[model samples]
Target chain A: MLKVEVDRTQCQNFGQCVVEAPNVFRLNSRDEMEYTPDVEDAELDNVEAAVDVCPMQAISLALGR
Target chain B: MSPPVVIVGASLGGLRSAEALRRCGYAGPITVFGDEPHAPYNRPPLSKDVLGGEVTHAAVAFPQRAATSDVEWRLGTRIRSADLEQRSIRTTDGEEVRYRALVVATGLRPKRLSPRTATLAGAFALRTLDDAAALRNALHPGVQVVIAGSGFVGCEVAATARQLGCEVTVVGSAELPMLGPLGSALAEDVMRRHVERGVRFRMGTHVAEALGQEAVEGVRLADGSEVACQVLVEAIGSLHNTEWLDGNDVNAAQGLRTDSAMRVLRADGSSWRDVFAVGDVARFPNAIYGDEPASIEHWNIPTETAKRASRILALQLAEDPRLDAAIAERFAPVPSFWSDQYDMSLLAYGLPALADRVELLAGKAGGDCVYGYFVGDRMVGVCGIGMRSEVLKHRDEVSRYGHVPIGEPAR
Candidate 1:
């Protein structure tokens, strides 16, 4: 499993991450971001892409035991 | 043994290049030089949160994703001169550093008004972290602030000043603020938003002179009208920081022109194989835009260009025979930039300057909307005001690499 974290304080809800990894991240109706805290390990690459494209660099990922 | 790869500027571009070099499996020593005494920090917030006093001084720091322990950091050291033939740069402290590969990311310096006006006590410009801190300190309630130029920096500063309860009066040479970049309709919308926020505008005019003999008491317009101000910020524009390349064949007056691969081009139009220019300092001919040479000053350009430069450097460091051929290859990443003012977050993809026609794609023009700029039948740029998802869809459609080019002619 992959554990994801987003620093909401730094996030401006640019939604670049959602476009890169839609399965892991999504924006609410208010245009704010909401993402899955944990996801399948196979989705690591997609999550990593999100990390790179996040405008605010607010996304962080950790691998689960 | 190969000489270490040396990166100048030590900001976003420099740091990202170092990290990308490591990711590319380059085992060589890496060194970064910065004129500023502090570590690399995020610059986009300098005019927003940093100037708004909404975030702490440390809040604006860019995440140091690049490991610093292995990299040699020469902070507060400015480069004075460069010798392209010798492949070395001399620092202001009289130190010469030779490198196997050089990455120039010196970026830009804010353009100030005349020395006479800029030297005034209350006159300022926000570029560096120190500049933002100083400007934030002056944003007391009811402080009359006069900002020259209606560019992103000036408008952002005005919005921030209003948030801090300061009275702001923006003076610009355009009839509507941000008309050059945001288009007249959206610019008028932004201007109206500012007016609704109680910020004043003196449009279609230029600042004739800085009022007050000691401090900036106000600004005298070309029409002989004076706007009272306790503080003055000249957010006019920026000049590329290329003075260190003074004697080099590259054009320092404009920007250091680079070939498709971001290699610095000499006056003879030959590529400097081991030397590359990244970030705002690099003026490269973009392949997507039909090889039009432009210097993009957006925040993301540095990161994207740095990655490309690192990939090329890595391939070269590995003694790959393809390095020579790769040097001539084109790197055309879809350019993007964003600006935040009050509640509006303007996002743009592709180059708006390349468009001849613009159409409203989704939503209303003044409200949350996406505007698409086209060159004939092809979408060249897409911009939005508070429209995130709609802009993303356009971004995907406009990008050459993103889900089939929207209007590519059959080859």
Candidate 2:
């Protein structure tokens, strides 16, 4: 398992992550970012894409959740 | 020791390319060369935050990942030319580097107002961090700033200058500012918003001459009118940094023409397997827009193209079984761009400018609204100001558009 973290302080809710990896990240009705903290190892590619597109550079992924 | 993969231009594209190479399982040596003195830094903020506030390299520098730590970085080294047939590149200082693979990530330089190439002290063009830093000092309260061009940079800088209490007057060639990208309606709204914020515009004209003795004092518009300015900012456009590729047989007339796989193509339409391009430099075909190749200089393009190019390069380097099959799945990256001017947060998916007509999709015309861009019957793009959620819903439609079955010709 890989652990995903988003620094809300830096996040502007650009929703780029939601476009890249919709399964793990989403924008709520208020347009606030809601994301899955833990992701399966198989979701690395998608999660990594999400990290790259985050203009704020807020998303982070690590091994061994 | 074998020759390493050499990537030119050390900005967002170069950094992303190096990182993607590692991600795609290429363990070999990678070297990136850049003309700028500083390491890779984000550029989007240069016109907004950095321009409005204190400008520094640290504030906008992209975070370096551990995976690409071993990648050699040669900053402030200008490559004079490259011989693709010889598989070698010569630096301006007479240094030669034989690269196993070359990634042409050299992006663009801002185009200045012609007829006057002199380096006036107060005159600036906001492309590099240095440009922003220099322009920052002249942007204090009550300074009369004349910005040439009405593109994103021009408008953004106008807004930022207004925020800093500078008197900004934007001179544009088009009837309305940002007419090429944003349609008339949204542009009117944007212009209205800017006007509300006290930013003036001189539409349907261009800066013919920068009038000054030493530092820029004013500009003479092509309309035969003169506006006194304390600072002059030329945000006209950009020229591709492809001059170093002079002797090469590559089609760099526009940007380097590339196949959908990111391989640099020759004038005869043959692609060089080892030479690829990414970011604003690579004019690759987008599936949503059919087979027409274009160089989209959006913020997301660097990371997107770098990842695709790295995947293919890594596979080729490793001699993977997947290499035999021509990339059947065409590179289908959904184009995206965003901008901030005053209180408006502009978000867009796909090339909205490519559309012939734009229709109201959701929300009111004057306020937060979504507009769907259409070509014929298919909705090609979606753009809106403020309605983030509503606008994003059509992202899939834009991605799936133009299924007209147009791609690389049979070759």
Candidate 3:
């Protein structure tokens, strides 16, 4: 399992993350950010791509204990 | 035998291109040349954390995200001349290298101030890690700093200087800072934020001259007014680093002109099949901008263009038939850029240069808000401060209907 965290204060919501990992992160009707805190190990690469494309350097990922 | 793939300018674009080649299963010899001795690093923080003494050059160096450990790197070397006819480049160290495919990512250099002002001891320009490190050390509490130009670099430096407890004043030739790309509404918001933080602005005036003979004592404005300062930082503009390609048919005056697929265009309006250009140095036509040849300085353009160039280069080298259709596709990516100043972060999507009108879609104009920039009826660009989610929603809309009609209700 993996845990993901996003610093809301630092995030500008450019949606580059959404384009990379749509299953993990998304935008709601009001265009606000929504994401899953935990994900399967198979989704690691997708989540990592999201973390890399973040413009504000807000996303972080770590393996769960 | 096909020659090795050669990449010039080992910055973000060059580094990414190397990685993309490997990802496409290109196991051939790959060589990267960079004039800078250091590895590719994130430049956005040079004006932010680097100037504020929050981080060192090593801290900002780009992480090894791609599989480029095998790529041969020639650091601290410059290509003096290039022979497009022979498909070879001469280096400063009296070495010539041949290439089957060439990728030019030379990027840009900061436009220098006047000869008089540029030669001043205390005056500086921020473009590389060394520049940021020196400026950070020079800036201290109570030091007076005057910045010329109100672009992203200039505004960001002012914010960092202010955070360092320095007396900062910014001079710009426009009525409002960044009024051209950000529009007047959002530009006003940015100006208000700076004023509230005690940073002074000298709008609609240029820096006529740099004061003092030995060092920069102050700067003289076009209005015959002088602002006393100990240091002067010039952030006027940047020119493409295309001097080495002088004898070539490239549009060196503007930038290296390229076709839609990022192929270099010769003087006769034809593109070189084996040569490609990326990053700030590539002036290529974009479908989103109505096929106009535009060079984007944003951080995202380099990454996107590099990916496209690598796929094309790999296909040619490997003679892969599986991805032949992919090569015919045009190079189009949703251009985006961000600027951090004080506590406010401004994020924009699409090319705002084509917009003729700017409208406040959400929030107050002078406050944290979102503004939609339109070219007549179509929305060409969107930018907002502290309105991250609101601006992200319009990303697809801006790409699909570049001329999306803005309703009167939003206005």
Candidate 4:
């Protein structure tokens, strides 16, 4: 499985993540993103997409069991 | 097995998120919904280039290479409801989209004048490309223009109006323009700049009403003073697009409240891991400023936050080992923003709201110079008028959380 994390301290709510991994990352009602912290291995491609799209460069990932 | 991705609000944040996803190698189909009929475009230049008649609307179109992932554009459609539990969204067109994840970048709208004033023909607000186009047409030579608020947008409009040869008067209740961010002293410099350029200032005054019948004929000040003008532009502030999420059980006010990871916070102040928010619509805490959450309205912050959100999402998908640590380290980017008014270019680094004190480091006031804002002894933010190269060099250091001598001059 893939693991996801966002640095809220650095985030300015730009919503670039929504465009990158719509399956895993989303902006909630207040125009903030609502996303899953973890996903199945099959969704790795979309998760990677999320990493590339975050404008603040606040997103990070690590391989896990 | 592909996961569905749905992004609402097809503007800068939406477009950049889509681009970032493609760059990160996501081949899944993507859907981007926008309330506007036009394709995603840059908005920064709307008040300047487009209004100045220096460039056409087409010139501001965000250049996109066809190879960048293809996004299913749902233009001219508004999202009526987002059923977070159902993992779906219902659009105004009655279409339901099921998504494994969602991104809300609905941004904010400009606050308008009261209905009593909006009925006047000359009243205007600039927030979108269309709004700028309409205002540009209304600005003609010899027109007397009265602008409300002395904020960045209002100041830019005032400068532009003067350049267009219009009789411009800016009315504000503050002693100087932009006292909120630039402070009264620097704001006075800005006000003086406009005065030197022939722009008039009605300082320490408030607009009681915008007067006119068919069009704006004049404005009534709180002091009972009447200033006649042919046009009025309201630049008071912006309202976040969060009313739709009313029953969504999320902790949302003017903007969505999010943690460092861009995840929406519950009403009880807990993170809602399943949902995330980005853009001007979300309010999150800053690490450098004692963890006080800030809602910034700038072009650069949104772009940077989206990139960080993407990386976090990718780690989750890859089952990253450092996921917990990564999330904890999120929200560390230094805040930065810039604005162009008349011949002056103002660049700001760090959050001015968090600064306890401000001092001029280099250059003279009312001229090309660099000013640094400090929180105690550490330089928390920097602002420069007409000094781009010097400011750009210090931006990285600020972003990396570097500190300059508090009261020392910038040599």
Candidate 5:
């Protein structure tokens, strides 16, 4: 399992992360990015893409023990 | 032991660096320091929707899932000293934090009018959210607003004020607005557009002083003309936040000099292994452009540079092949930016400042069209105004390693 996080203080909600991982991340009604923190191992590829596509570089993932 | 990553400046660049570090699978402790109290919010909308009263301050908050990653957010604080040799930073609160890797993203601050003028009740300049909010409150119907500059920020504010039914006048020393970037031909079109929207332009006029006893009442120009207004919004350019690095060997000036990989360069033009810089605070060379170090004040470079910095940090920690050469090439992505003014949406691909020639590819002057700029024979940049589809198409072509054909198309 992987845990994804974003620094709310730094993100500008440009939605570049959503384009990288649509399932794990999304832009809320306020036009800010909303996402689930935990993702299945199978979705690692998309999550990694989210990590790259984020314009504000506002996403992070941690491998569980 | 994995060293803690210290990020200075909680703006887009620093914030993105922290996020990129997590994305790169660094589970080590991360700390972010910001000078402002509020959480990171989108600034583009501040001059638009927020000023137009279409959105509230809370509405601009960038969304993040609560469990994204555990990060130590030190808000309302700033890094007073960065000791690169010791890899430590001292904050304004007297706390010292050591880092294995540091990302400096301290963005620029707006150049203000003299303190005497700024101390006036209604004088304003928009750089942060608070600045925007204050400027927003002063925009009411029939409020005479005198904008000091006609650059991107000034033009945007003028449009917003016009939308709010405020009497707006833009004062600048340029023959045409934005001649420094878009050149005379295009700047003239921009000036025409604003003029058609009821904005008065005082070209070649310099401000002698802002006239007011307690509050902003008018502006005295060099030509001995007084333009009266209730609000004075100065949209002059910005000064990069690099003064804190004084006395350090780091090549610091208007911005920190960096390479393609976003590594901060030393005085002798050597990259600092553990020190990286990004955003408006970094001045670096563009691979596509010439060797001149280009410093973009746009929103895209910071986010892009942060990701590149994160990759380098991860590789260094992992002890991967010290392939700095390969990594630098992969990190140098094309520069792109956009801005929205009134009903027109402008998108620019690549860096136009490096271009030698510009041609109107599809649209009329100021109409819906894609304008292509080139450096020698290569298509370096494209600017689109009201031509979103064409812009996207050309953007895709440019991104795919394509170029604009040598001569004019068979129109």
Candidate 6:
């Protein structure tokens, strides 16, 4: 599993991450950004992609604890 | 030891290129040259947040990756020129570096008018962190500010300056700001928003001369009008930084002309497989837009082009059988750009400027709305304010629109 972190203050809820990693990140009813804390190892590419697409540069991923 | 793949321009594109090369199983050495002393940092906020608050390089710099930890970063080293035939570049500090392959990602420098017309002290152009920091210091409450070119950066800075309590005025040669890209309908809404926030617009005219002795006191417009302001910002446009490739025989005058594979071309239209360009400096054809090659300066282009370039270039370097197949893959990157002016966040996909016709798809003209940009009957792009989901949905549709594929798909 991989750990995902998003700086809420920096994130503008662009939802670009939602488009790239649909299985991990999402937008709530209010349109604010939300994401899974842990993702499968197979999702590393998708997760990295989500990190890249974030206009705020607020997303990061690391190995799960 | 084999020469490293040297990537010029140590910004997002250079960093992404290095990472993509490693991902493609290229075990060779990599070197990235950047003129800035600081490492790669996101530049979007330079026109927004950094102008409102503190300016720190560490706050915005890209996180260090273990994969590229070994990659040599020649920061603070400016390349004077490149010798394409010799496969080497010389730095301004009298250092020569050779590379087996080169990635041109030098990007651009903001085109300035005050340098010749007015003093540099109170003039600004926001492209780097330093520019933002300097501009931030000058943006005091109730200070008169004049911005040239009411484009993306100009309108953005106008918004930021207003937030800082600066009396802001944007000089534009169009009836509305962002009229070229957003079109008149959406652009009028944007201008209205700016006007509501106390930002003034001087439309259908541009700054002819910035007048001052010690610093910019005001500007004389080409229409024989004058606006007095203490601070002047020229966000007119950007000039290509392709001068370093001067004697290279490549058609870099417009931009570093490249094929769909990112291979740079000679003036005679022959491509140099070893030299590639990504980001704002590269001009490549988007079949979705037509066969006419253009340099799309959208923020997403650097990442997309670098990844594609590195993927194919890695295969070629490794002599992998997959090289030809990789080159044959269809690369139709949907250009995306966004602007955060106050509470109104404008997001778009595809090239809106390429459209001859625009139709309102959703919402009110004065409020949150989505616009479909069309070239004749075919939809070419989409732009919206506050309708993120609706706007994003059109990305695929526009990307698939008129995709005259130059090569066979990998599948």
Q: What is candidate 1's local distance difference test score?
A: 0.82
Report the Cα interface RMSD of each model, rounded to 1 decimal.
1.9, 1.0, 2.6, 11.8, 6.6, 1.4
True-structure RMSD, every candidate? 4.0, 2.9, 4.1, 10.8, 6.5, 3.3
Candidate 5 per-residue lDDT, tens place, B1-411, comes to 766787888877777788777777777888888998876766777776578875464756555533335878888998888788888888877888899888898888888878786577889988888888888888999999999988778888899999999999999888877655565656777888889999999989877789989898999998999999999998877788987777677887667988777889999998898888988888876554444465777666777788888878878777778646546574445566655567666666665554578888887886766777766767666777755445545654444343322121000
Q: How many clashes does the backbone of model 4 have?
A: 73
Ranking by DockQ: 2, 6, 1, 3, 5, 4
Between candidates 1 and 3, the DockQ winner: 1
Q: Which lDDT tens digits does candidate 1 get at residues B1-411?
A: 767899999888898888788877897899899999877878888888667765454676665653445888898999999888888999998999999889999998888878787678888988888788778888899999999999889999999999999999999999988776666667888999999999999999978888899888888999999998989999988888998888877755467888888889888888888899998888876667656457877777787788888888899889888887876676777777788899998888886656667789898977899888777778877889876877877776566632223222100
Query: Which CAPRI tier for candidate 4?
Result: incorrect
Question: What's chain A's TM-score in each predicted model?
Answer: 0.95, 0.95, 0.94, 0.86, 0.88, 0.94
Better of 4 and 6 by lDDT: 6
Clashes of 2: 0
lDDT of each residue in B1-411, candidate 3, tens digit only: 667789999888898788788877788888999998888887888998667865575667766654678789898999999988899998999899999889999998888778776567889998888788878887898999999999889999999999999899999999998877787777888898899999999999989889898999999999999999998999999888898888987676577888777889988888898899988888877666556677878888888888788887788777778555776675567778788888787788876655788888998766678889887777878888866778877887677623233221010
Each model's number of backbone clashes? 0, 0, 2, 73, 3, 0
Of 1 and 5, the candidate ranking higher by DockQ: 1
Q: Which 10 residues in a row give candidate 1 chain B its minimum summed lDDT? A: B402-411
lDDT at B137 for candidate 1?
83
- Sliding window of 10 residues with minimal summed lDDT for model 5 chain B: B402-411
Clashing pairs in 6: none
Residue B216, model 2, lDDT: 84
Model 1 DockQ class: medium
CA lDDT of every candidate: 0.82, 0.87, 0.82, 0.72, 0.75, 0.87
Which parts of model 3 are misplaced by more than 4 Å? A1-14, A27-52, A57-65, B322-324, B401-411
lDDT of 6 by residue, B1-411 (tens): 989999999998898999989988887899999999989999988898877889899767898888888999999999999998999999998889999999999998888884564336788888998888888999999999999999999999999999999999999998899998898898999999999999999999999988887778999999998999999999988877899998888997667899888989999998898999998888887666556577888888899999999999999998999889988777778788899999999888877776779999998888889999887777777999987777877878878837433231100
The two-chain DockQ for each candidate, comma-separated, is 0.51, 0.68, 0.43, 0.03, 0.09, 0.59
State candidate 3's DockQ. 0.43
CAPRI-style grade of the A/B interface in model 5: incorrect
